[model samples]
Each structure stands twice: as C-alpha cells, then as structure tokens.
Target: MSADALTFDCIVVGSGHAGSCAALAARDSGCERVLIVEKSPPEWVGGNGYFTAGAHRTVHGGLQDLLPIVKNVTPEIAANIDLAPYTADEFTRDVMRLGDGRSHPDVVKALVDGSRDAVQWLAERVHVPFIFSFNRQAYLVNGRQVFWGGLALSVEGGGKGMIAADRAALAAAGVETWFSTAAIELVIDGDRVVGLQVSREGESITLRSRAVILACGGFEASKDLRAQYLGPDWQRAKVRGTPYNTGDGLALAQRIGARLTGDFAGCHSTCWDANAPDDRGDRVLSNQFTKSGYPLGLMLNAKGERFVDEGEDFRNYTYAKFGREIMSQPGGFAFQVWDSTTIPWLRKEEYADDVVERIWGDTIEELAAKLVEKGLEDKDAFVQTIRKYNEAVRAFQAERPEAEWDPAVKDGVSTQSSHLQLSLPKSNWALPVEQSPFLAVKVTCGITFTFGGLAIDPDTAGVLSDATGKPIPGLFCTGELVGGLFYRNYPGGSGLTGGTVFGRKAGREAAKLSGAAR
Candidate 1:
C-alpha cells in the first residue's frame, strides 16, 4: 500500500443505519481508524433508514419500563396509554410466525436478544430522542392508549432525524466518511479481504484495510435483478427508498464465493400511491407516499374484485407480503375503498398530495360510476362486491351480538356471507361500508429493501464462506447485506433493530480481526 494512499484499520461500506452503526461500534471496539464509504451523495446518505418512520419493534416491559428511554413521556400521559410488555419470547414468536419458522433461528435469536441493547446503544452514541408511535403501532382503547403489534419506540425525528443523529455520532467519534464514493470490488488477499477498490467522479483508487464490513443494501432497486429474483412484474413496482440500492455489495460478495441466504424473491413492500413517481419519492415526502390504511378498508382490483383478505391480520404483520399479492393482480394495480365510518380510523395517507388518485362519491352507485370514468374495468362487478361485503358485515355483527369497533386489538369485527361467501374472508376490523361519501384510492405495490443477502456467522456477524463452511477472515457484514434472518416475512420495525444488533457485532469482531492482522 502506498504510504500517502488512504487506509483504515476497518473500512465500512455504506452509510445507512447499519453501516453508520458499524463505524461507531468499530471505534468503540478500539479500532484506531474506521472509514464509512457511501455510494450515495451526501444528501441521501442514510439509505432506507431515511425513508422509514424509524419506529423500532423491540422487547420492553411496557411504558413504565421505557420511561428512562422515552424521557419525554409525562406520568400523566403514561397513565392513558397501555404499553404492554413485549418479552423476548414474544419477539421470537413474532419472527418465527411471520417467517413461518423459516428464518434462521440463530439470526432471529441474535436480533431478539440484542434488540433492547441496540436501541440503548444507539441512543447513547447518537443523542437521539425516542418516543411512542401513536399513529400506527398503538390505538386508543377504552380511553387508554394501548400499544400492540410489539412496536413501541421511534426516533424523535423519524427516519430523517435518526439519520441525522447517526451522522452526528459518526462525526463525534472522528470516523471518516466518503459520500458519492462507491466500492467497485473487494480486494481479497489470498484467503482474507485486505483492501477495497473504490471509484469517485471517474477517479479510481484502492484503499487498504485490515478488515471490511459490507452494510450496503440489497437488489430492490435493480429492475433486472427484481425481474430475475422477484419475478418479471416486480420491475414495475415503485421503489420505496434509494435507487442507489442496486445490489452492489451483494454482487461484489458473490464474486468472492459468498453464499446468499433467505428468499431472493421476497422483499418488504407496501401499498404505495399509484400516482407516485416510478423512482423513490423525495425524502421530504418520506413516509407519506404510501397508504397503510388498507386494514380499516377494502381493496379491489381493476375488476373491482376483493383479491386478498383485507382483514386477515394486523396491517403490519401482513402488509409487506400483501404488496406482492397486489402486484400479481390483474393490471398490477388495485384500489382501496372505504367510507366515512372507516375513514376516521384509517392511517393517514389520504391527504398526502394533489397527485393522490381517488374517486369520492356520496353513494355506492355514484362511487362505482366515478370509478368507471377513472378507467375501472367493471363498475357492475364493484357494485356486486360491495353489496356482498356489506351484507356479510351485518351478518357478522348480528351473529356476534356484542361486536364493537376496536382498533387496539383484533376486535374480531369481521364479515361472513352465506349467499355470497368470499373466497378470502375478512378476519378482523371489518365494518360495513354503508356510510357516505365513499372513497377509493388507487394503489400499487411499492417494494422496500430485499431479504436476500450473504450468509453470516450469527455470533460474530462475519460473512461465512460457502466453500469453507466458516467465516471469511477479515470479512464481516450487517444490515440488508446480512441475510438468513428473514424469509417469507419480517416483523415491522425490526429492520433497524436487526441492523443495530448485527452492525455492532460485525464492528466489534472486525476490529478484533484488524488487531490480529497487525
């Protein structure tokens, strides 16, 4: 290595939540110099972490126990909200159940066990303020705020704020960061990775490093990769975050005999606004570009047919997978239908911007007619579907005798029909859409980060060699690059937690490897 050329004790690729955290951990782990290389320009430094709400789904003993972490919560406010204890076992069950027990147990355990600590560690280093997520993760129950779905705290400024806080932490730790610089290849020295080839503004250079941590994201933004792994139709799906996440790290690692893990086709997706630009929407819009209110309403395809069961489970539990289902529907599009009765409780997305495409009407017939004018294939089919659903809702209410609308819990306010039974019945939070004026929002699939990535040594967060069946010395990874933690689905808010959990582990171990290399 040239004496004047840049070098680091540990070099981290990507400046997302995982990469930033890894840099901080490397410094804390006694590494003399840690450098973070971000492919994105300085403006878009945080990857998907900047696009998220920054809500963390972690285990906690409830509001009382979280008082220390969320110091802003007053005692008076605490009495109204019920923050139930989400134990480690519950975290494990959520992960296994969501993944259908397909997620690697070791990876899940590492995430669950280190979750709380991860939040605390980030908090101490970054000076970020965390608070209860009032809008989505909790509901007002019997005049008390009852938190459910195992999601509790969030960074005060959401993802944007959290990213800023992480950047602050990086600067404070004296870590070097390179924005708009991309790592082209991993410089493998025989059996160990010893340096990295990077390019910036058409200039190329190689930087030597004792150890490397790859925290750049997956292939969600690559249309070709999406078609290759997630199917052809996925290429049209709107990207929920940075377009820079085109599987650069994954592609580089694969060249070095890394074994990829999890479902390459499976990704975290949601109901994005149909009118949203093809690329990731601006960071200023942030979490507002998508609609998460489908649970409180119904979704219909171009045929105006109810495709997936809108009330199958809590929105967060099923929203990601359901986006893929929508993409599979005819025209690769769907519309969300709701009425005044459901509008009050829906997650806020209706008021996003003038670009929102929705048809509003005072009556079902009018709504159907308006939808037809907006290019719906079959208005008659929509009318029949609505009538059948409304009839089922009444039947369910009469059958239960004491059914009431409760958002805090899966209130079992469902629908059933004998005359016109739905192939996919609504399971919970089902209310008749009889109230007016009715509304329908056009929606399509918006994919977030992908699940496929390099296999890892769960304990050390070191990338394991597919051929050797052991960790590749001097190589570690975290965030979306570290796979085997998820399969079919993932727990909401667990992405940040997973990054923190493994990022710390990778950083510590990489620092140790740097020492050994010396």
Candidate 2:
C-alpha cells in the first residue's frame, strides 16, 4: 500500500447512536478530520436509536449539577428547567438491584455520573427537544426526577427528535461519512490500532487513523450467535428490531483478543409473540399487552394449563413463559385469551389494533376455531380451557365486586391495572371467555438487543483485552459493543443513556489523542 493511500485524524466504525455521537464530539473538540465508516447505507442512520422510546436517566442531581460543568448547557437554561436530582447512592442501588448485582460498578458509576451532562449536551447542542412527560410513564431524570416524555423521539416523530437532529449536526460539523463500507478488521501496529480495512462496493481499501472508535452494535439479530451465546431458547424466539446486527464487530474484536463480559446473552421476554413467525413479517404489538397493563383472561401452555402470573414483569414473564420453562410442557408455547371488552380497551388505550385484529373473535368458539385454522392451537383443547376459565372468572366475580377483582390475582408486584376503573367489571376480566368471540394468539418472547459484548473501562471507554486486563491502545468501544455495564437486567432507559454518555467520552478522548499525534 502507498503511504498516501488514505489517512484521517480519527475513524469511527458504525453510524448508530454511539458512532454518531462520537463523530460529532470529535469534530466539536476541534479534530480537523474525522471519518465514519458504515457498512449499511445512510438510510439506516441511527440504527436502533431511531426505534427507541428515548427516556434518559441518571443517578446524579439532574440538569442543575451538570449545567455548571458541561460545556453544552448554560446555567440560566438549566435553572429554568425543572430539574430532578437523584443521588449516586440511590442510582447505584437501583441499578444493582435491577442488574441482580452482575453489572460492573465502575461502568454504572460512569454512566450515572455523566448522564446529566449527556442529556443536556444532546438537548442543548443538537436541538433535540426534551419533554417531561408522555403516555403516563414518567421520565427518570438524573435518576431521581420523574419527568414526562424526556426521551428521544421514535423515528416516527413521537417526541424527542434527537436521532435526526444528531445526524444533521454530525454532517454540519463536516464529518466524512462512507456508507456501504464495512470495517473488516482493525489495522493493528503492535499493541495499538492504526486504522481499519474497509470493503465498499466490492473494493477493499485501508484507512489510516491515529485513533479508532468501534460502535458497531450487538448481535441480537444473529441467529447463529444467539444460539451459540444466548442458548437454544433464543434460537426459537422472535426478534423485535433490525435483523442486520450479526455481531460482526464483536467477532472481529474478539479475534483481535478483546475480552467479553456481562452474560453470554441477555434478553427481555415480555410483550413477545411466542409463536409469531421468526421472519418478523407480522407486526407484533408489545405496548398494548405488556405496557398497557392489559388483563390476561387465560394463559395456557401447549398442554392447555395456566402456568405463570400473567401480570408479572412483562419482559421477565415472556422469557420464562416462552423459554424451556413453558415450552418444555406439552405445548411448545403459550396462548393468551381475552374477550371483546379487552380488545377495545387494548385498541383505545394501547394503540394495538394489530394485536387485537390478530386474535379477535366474535364468539369464544369462533376464536378457538380461528386459532385451530391458523394451526396455532388444538381447537378442542383451547375451547375446553376457555370454558373452564370463564367459569372461574364468573365464580370470582360472584364473590367479589367487579372493581375488587384482580386479573393477575396471584402477583408479587401487581401490574393488574393501570386504569383502575377499567378493571371493575367482573365481565372486564380478560376472562369470561364466554363473551362470544374470544381472542387467542400464540405468543412468544422477542428480544431487542443482546447484552453480552467486549468489556471496557467506564472511565476511558477503551476496549479491554482479557489477556492483559487493560485497555487496547487506539481502540475505543462503546454502545452494545462494550458490555458488563448493564448486568443482566436493564434499568428502564439506561441502554440509550449509556450509549450517549460513553459515545461522547470516546469521541472526546479520541480527539485528544488525534491532537497529540498532530
């Protein structure tokens, strides 16, 4: 290769949330030339960030504490916004509790400490609107303040509009973007990364750089990797987002001796269709049944028996209900049955007409017949189960006021009802499968992202090699590529929070390295 083949101050791989932030931060920090290499086209900008519900949380005092230290936010604006402050201790406790003590303390601390600034930086600098409320769930500001609607807008333009805004900012900053270019490997010179070998339009080229950032995302969409790392159960589950994430970056990094951490793979189980086609051609509505607190009139496994507390944590419940726990039974999965009353509620409140349509029946027998027609269940058995459940619901309602009856009668944390008035009629039970046209849909767990990835230092955002227990020089990894930070469980909106905070850190640090080289 010629000496002038290609060169840049910094090279960032991938154009997801992390890579976008990294590129922007580097340029803003005065790096003269930064290049972003993306295997996919620009139409795929923001990666999963475009599909997110955009809530951000931090463990530190809200925007107030961060405004003074962060360059992006002004004291006047910070003071004007209603700020919610959460102590580091409380944040730590919540994270640890949610993670089941498996997450790295340092990573959690870095995310929590830097979160306020990250949120402010994106809002103030990128022109992304940040609200305090949306759809009833409060935004956990600074890990303390429960603000409404303070999340990035879904690409559909739900609210927080940072995904598009950030992309625009990166372009305005003159960050060179090479789409349809895949980074095949890290160009290593001794222990340091020199740059990347890229393939674009069938041409292989080498790009030289002083610093490199890996933000290529995780392996949730790769069936082979999911089966290998996440176990057989994952192989059979449905996937929620983009199907292109095959863990190419993670595999490449490992080949170069990067250590992996967190679990082999962790997934959210709730709101997934247990038997929805793996091709994901069918639109599965999760918000309706999972987030809207809908009642499960009857939950039956393949053998037609109730197996779990329907109202438990939707993510966890889905996993347990779909995995070997329920699949090992006579039926490979479970079917959720509800009535006409439930369908309208799901449609009006949950915006889940898709789900309602899939399972709707005008009569209990018709619904059971439909499932049989779809090859989703045994017609006779499903009908019998509905009859039994209806009898039980009627008995329960006869004894107690409709308002007093809980759909998730057995529950540790009862999410049985969000709109309490809706649960008052015993007939409102996702029960009485008697309401002629019953609804039944075979459901399975669907995963959003895999948690396992390269281990990194929270302070530097540097990818650490297992052999040396130290960061690999010139190589910084962020987003889903870096793991052991989230533990096995997620803390509400922490996924996006970590990505933004660490992406900024990596970009800034990479810029500093580039400056030194010059």
Candidate 3:
C-alpha cells in the first residue's frame, strides 16, 4: 500500500480499552481519519485490559445515583442493595494511601475528578454493559447486598464484555484498526513526533500521522524487564494478562526523549492460581484464576507461617500487595486455607472445582499433611500455625462477644484484644479454622501491569519531553503507559477508570493538534 493510504489524522498504538477510547474520542472530536495499531495478532487483541475484572471506581451518591447507568440493577434488586456514597475525597484518599502518598497530586486529582464522567461516557457512548459488581464487590448480610471497598460497578461479562463493547464502539465511530502491527519507533520531526515506524508482515513501514497516542501498556509480561526493574523475584511472576505488553510504548517514547516516571520497582500483582498458564492469560477463564479469598481465610507460606496480617484491610485494598509478599516466600507460592464457615462464601468464579485445584481434609492436621505433597516444606509447622491462629481468634471472640463477624464492613472482629494477641493479627473478620472439611488452594504471584511508564501532562495527557520538561508536541499517552498515578501499590478498579479518563483527554488534544497541523 502507498504511504498516502496509511496516513491518518491521529494514530493510537494498542487496541485495548485505552486505545479504543482514544480512537473513539478522536473521531467524536472531529478527527477525519483515526487509526489504532495493535502489536498482538487478532487472537490476542485487547492487551492487559482483556484480563481485568472490568471493575471501575468512580464517585457517586450511592445506589440510587448509580442505578440509572447500570443495566443489571432493576428497581426490585436495587431495593435490597445498600451502597454507601463513594465521594471524590474517599477515592482520592484510597489511591494516595495505597500508593504510599507518592502518587502525583495533580494526576490523582484529574483521575478522581474525571472518573464519573468517564464512566458515564463509557456506558452511554461506548455501550459498555455496566452492572453492579454483586459477585466481586458486594456481600450478602442479613438479606441485604452491602457493597464495600468503594467499588460498585463492573462490566457485564468482565473483561471480555468490556473488549467487545469497545470494539463495537470503535467500529461504529469509523476508527480503523490494524492488528499484528508492532510500532518500532516514534517518527521524530525535530523535537516533535510526526508519525510512527511499524513492523507489519515482517516489513518496516512508516505510517504518517499528525499526532500519536501511546496506550500499548507496561512491561509486566517481559521477564527481562521485570527482573531488571522490579527485581529477580518478579522474573518468576506469572503474567495475568497478554504477553504482548513488553514495554513497547515505553521504549518507543523514550527514543524520542520522553521522560519516564512512577514506581519502577513496584507493580500491581495478585494471588493467582498456581496451576494457571505462566506466559499468557486464559481467554475463557480470564480473571477467574485470581485467588483473592486470602482475606476471608489464612495465607501460609511454605514454611507454614503467616507472613502478613491477612485481614489488614478489605480484599480490594490488600490483594495487590499480597502477591509480592507471597513471591518473597519460599518457592514463590502460598496456600489459602478456609473452613466450612467461609469456604461457602468464597467467590465461586475463582474457587470452583473446575477453576482451581482443591485439597480437602476433615481436620487441620490432615489438611497440613495433604499440603506436604504440594510444596509445604514443614507439615508440623503448618498445623501449629493454624492452631495458634485459631487460639487467637477464640481469645478475641471471648473478649468481644458483642462484635459479630460481618464481611460487609470492618466490624472490629479481630485476633488481637486485651486477653491475648498474636504477633501477626488478623485485624478483621477473625474466624477460627476448626470446622470439618477444610480446603486449601495453592497460589503464585500474578503480575498485572508495571508501574513504570511515560510521564505526561495531567490535564492533556501529552507525553512530556525529558530534555525540555514540557509537553512533547504531537505526542500523547494513556493507559498503563501513562504513569505517576500510582507508586508502590494501587487501589482496585482505578486502572480502567483512569485509562478512560486520560484517554478522552489525550484524544481531544490530539484531534486539536491534528487540525492545527493541517
């Protein structure tokens, strides 16, 4: 094809949620010809966004305020739901707290302020099937579905549904997309980006464009990059998303003097099923491989010791960092143990018999013995750990008989009290593992996305030049490639919302750049 045929007003790299949103926004903003180029083949399309749970964190006035946008919540169902308002301040605090206060204030403010409008645009414009996250974010308590962790919405079919909706929107908006097109470098015109050089059909081709947006994602899937940036332990971490995100956007932008920022040594990792594929995510099972029930039970390392306070906070807030803790353990794996009391409450999507390998025992001793074959180095240590944990639970229960175990809220049902306290306390929902038919599931670290990425202007999502410390004209970024929003850890559900918010801004700015250049 001729170079003129490949020319576009704006070109977005990556066909994931962020890129799709950018392309659609460019078209809506009056860009005559917008294009998206994805490195992965047609089969591996959506990048890391396809493996997400599709949860989106946004500010709202509670259940009533969200019901109008969600398709799953009928009037009758909404009546039985109790969803507290998630304010902008609360959302901002969650990101800052999880990021250890290293998150850029301006970037975080833009994310928090734009989240609601971005979600609404996704629902109304992109036709993403938004639904109340009943299974993943809510718990049944006294016949009422109480939502916690400031997260209440998800796509209908999780990540798969989200990608489908985005594809449809892109096609409807007349945005052209090309798969198996790997961007090699940003075509630099003096200090500004003018186009992209890409590899297609094993041939290097230069595609001209007035502006470019990088949304191809982070370096979590590259073992070399992970080992180099996040440490050697990260080399063994299983990829929870596409294997295609090997820092292409970061490399491409850095070649043009783009500044790199954010947490290079940190990432969003999670407890994943040990038996799941290590290189790529399973499209059919997708996010179901996550083993997030550790908060509802106990996580013991191979040494049969509790490393973290399992109930330090809600599962949404703590799951990301716990994977790093598990990776630092012997064999880079851990087991989650739950008795009949909470096993029934485990998310069926994650713990179903067909989803993960399960080991069952009538007693704690037998359970520990069974785990010996599955990498538990010391059987006796495992049994003793549970015994001590149960004793602490019982002691706390005796001291606070008035405190009931409510998974829906922080009820102060803890393992530490005036009577006795364990060294590592389950600070909330402390339940004893004394029930018969105990279950155990092995888990390993699943790397979601890397925290290190390109630095961008908070308002326009324009990539900043490392040399000038200013916006690089005609260069923009979004998705996991745009950084400084997170530091050491991440608040659950913020990724998708942040990606869309910045993607919209990037697209509008890029469209204006394209018009001015013409």
Candidate 4:
C-alpha cells in the first residue's frame, strides 16, 4: 500500500448519508486527513442513501420555524398551510411509542436533542435542498394544506438530490473517497482500532488510520441473514435499498467483541409494489415503489379479510410495521383497494400509471374477480368482505352524522358503532369502498434496514465493547449499523435524521481521538 493511503487520520467505512456526514464533520472538526471507503462501484456511490425518499424528521416550531430553511414554501402557500410545532418531547414520545417503549432512552434522547441542529447543519453545510413535503405528508382540508403527521420536510428531489449535495460537500471539504473498496476486517492493536484491511479490485491492502467509523448499514439485503435473524418469511422479502449492506460492519465489530444491541428480529419494512425487484432497489424509480395509500383505502389479504385497521393512524406512524403484516398474510401479499374518492389523492409518484400496475373495476365484485387472477383465493369471500365493510361504513355514518371524513386529521370516520360493528374495524377515515371505477394495487413486503446492530455510547457514538461494557477505543459507529433506537416499528423520516445526528457526533469524536493519537 502507498504511504499516503496509510496516513488518513480517520477512515470511514461507507459512503452513504451517515458516512458523508462523518467525513464532512471530521473535516470541519479539524481532522486534516479524512477518507471514505465505499464497497460499491462509483456508479453505486451513496449506498442505501441513494434509494431513500429523503424525508428528514426534526424538531421545529411549525411552518414558520421551517420557512427559513425550506425552499419550496412561498408566502401565499405558507399562509394556507397548517403545521403544528413538533416538540422534542413529542418526537421522543413518538420514537418510544412506535418502538413499543423498547428503544434505548439515551439513544432516543440524543437523537431528539440533536435533530434540529443536525438538519440545519445539513441545510447550511451540505446544501441539501430542503422543502415542505406537500405531496407526501399534507392533505387538503378546508382550503388549507394541513400537515397531519409530525414529519413535514423533505429534500427537493428526494434521495438522488440529497446524495448529489452530499457528494459536492465532501468534495468541497477535500475528503477523498475510494470506491469499490470493501472493508474486509478491522485492524486492531491492543484495544484500539488502528486501521482497516480492505479489498480493492481483488487486491487486499492494509490502510492505517487513527480512528475508524462503521456506517456501512444493516443486513437487509442478505437473504441468509434475513432468514437467520428476521425470520424465514423475510428471506422472500424484497430489499428496499442497496444490496451492498450485508452486515460487513456488524461482522467486523463482532470479530473484536463489539456488543450486539437492539431488535434482531425487527426491521423497518414497508408495503412495496409486488412487481418490484427482489434483490435490490430500482435506482431510476427509487422509493416510488412504496405503497402507502392503504391509509386512504382498504387492504385485504388473500382470505378476503381486513387483517389490520386501515386507518389506525397516519401513514407516517403505521407504514413501517404494515409490511410485516403483509408478509404474514397468505401468499405474502395484499391488495390496497381505493375508490375514485381517494384514488386521485394517492401520490402520483407512487400510484401513477407508469409507476405501478393498477387494476380497475366498475364494481366491487368485478374488482374481486380481477384480483383472483393475481392471488385472491376466494372471489366470493372478497366480494362479501367489501359488501360487509360498506354496510359498516353506512351504519356508522347514519349514527354519527356530524362525523365528517377528513384525512388531514384522525377524523373519526370509523366503521364501528354501538348498534352495528364488524369484527375488525377501520378506525379512522373509513369511507365506504362503493364509488365506481375502484382501483386495487398488489403489494408485498419490502425490508428497508435491520434493527439489530452494534451498541454504542450515545454521547460520543463510540462502539461499546462486550467484554468491558465500555467504549471501544479508536472505534466509533453510526447510521443503521448503530442500533438500540428502534424496535418492532419505526417512525418515518427518523432514520435519516438519526443518521445525521450520530454521524456528526461520531465524526467529531473520531477526529478528536485522531488528534490525540497524532
């Protein structure tokens, strides 16, 4: 290996959002020599980051507070938008609530505390094109765009745009990145990680460094890992991100006795198009394959039964766990049925004719008949299910005439009443699927990232050692590789914000350690 290759103060293993944030933060924190090694080729530079929707959840005082950072909102538009302030306490509660209170308090607190600052840093330093998520998170209510969910901001062109800005920022910071460099092992001297042994173009080279941060992501793409950790059904699940995240960081850390933490059996999965590729994400279409329109409609399994309450909560709160539900259904797939009333409201980016295959039927029975060809086992059961659901909706509407259908808030338009009720109720926004020209889209589970990863110190983002129950010297971790913040389910957009927050911390800490070593 060249002498220059062995001289980096900090070597980051990955080039995703977290790695980029780490490299940039290292340079800013006074690390003179920083390097990022990517396992994928130059074309696949941003790892799983390139496949994200770029939704960033952060603490802010409603629309006014975010106005300064976002580029999409205008004076006229801002006046017609309704967005409530998202407090740190609220964000903290959401993370814990969705995680079934299993999330590590320290990790959750660190993420919540650093969220706003991390977002601002990204906007200012990395020049990420921030915009109000009008198309995805808001709904038209009484001539105003009401942002229902806690999330409200996203990048201009989503993941692709964010990655472009991150790459540019890395270049401006003079951080060198070596593509197609796979981290084979972590080189340790005593208790400190001194360097990395990597394979570049079939040649193994040892590159020395003062500190190393593993942000290479989780084992979502490995079918074997999925079967071993996330259950056998997950082996058939489609990967929603980069195929390169096969637990290399976890494997390297395990070799050195890094403590394993978080939910090994849980992951951030989503309802994706049934036709989407199984092994990897589509770079061109990216996250558009996501099928989150179920909140506005009905999701029926092959048994022609509503397994989950379609409107238990906003899409942001419930989309992540619904994928696991879909995986458990017969044939490991479900159909999202929406009438003309809600069809137009479905995000065009996701439900557009060119994006996903859509099946149309003039009547409920016809839709059921068409769905039988896909995977519906009982056509008669399917037809009866919709009829019963429609009756429940009618009965509820008759009892509570004042209960209006509002998607912006959890409008109590439910299918359950004291007089007449179904076994499983559509809790909110339960408009009957009776409108003509109904639409149904086939969907399957798409695993995003695994929740099982290395344990770390929330303050310094240092990987914790299993032997001593302390921070591993000269080693740090961030991104999806550092877990203990999520379990069972994940709140939408928190992943990106958490990555940035901990990535920034890891970078600064690693840089400090590097200086001390020098």
Best candidate according to lDDT: 4
lDDT of 1 by residue, 1-518 (tens): 37435778899999999999898898888888899988989888899999888888788887777778774578898879887899999999988998878899998999999998888887777777788888778888778888778888887778898899998888989998888999999999888999888998888979888789999999898999999998999989999899899999898888998888887978998888887778775688777777888888899999989998888778778877888888998888888988998777765544433547667899988998887766589988998998989888888777777878787788877776444455678888888888998988888899998998999998999998989889888888999987888877888899998999999998898788778322
Q: Between 3 and 4, whose lDDT is larger?
A: 4
Per residue, candidate 2 scores C-alpha lDDT tens digits across 5-65 of 4888888888777788888887887678889988777666566565455555655456555
Model 3 vs. true fold: TM: 0.99
> What do the candidate models score in CA lDDT, each in turn?
0.85, 0.63, 0.92, 0.92
lDDT of 3 at 286: 92
Error of 2 at 192 (Å): 0.8
Worst 10 residues of 3 by lDDT: 509-518
- Per-model TM-score, in order, reads 0.97, 0.77, 0.99, 0.99
lDDT of 1 at 82: 82
lDDT of 3 by residue, 321-343 (tens): 88899899999999999999999
Cα shift from native, residue 143, model 3 (Å): 0.7
- Select the stronger candidate by lDDT from 1 and 4: 4
lDDT, candidate 1, equals 0.85
Each prediction's RMSD over C-alphas, in Å, is: 1.8, 7.0, 1.1, 1.2
> lDDT tens digits, residues 435-489, model 4?
8999999999999999999999999999999999899998998999978999999
TM-score of 1: 0.97
Residue 222, candidate 1: alpha-carbon lDDT = 92
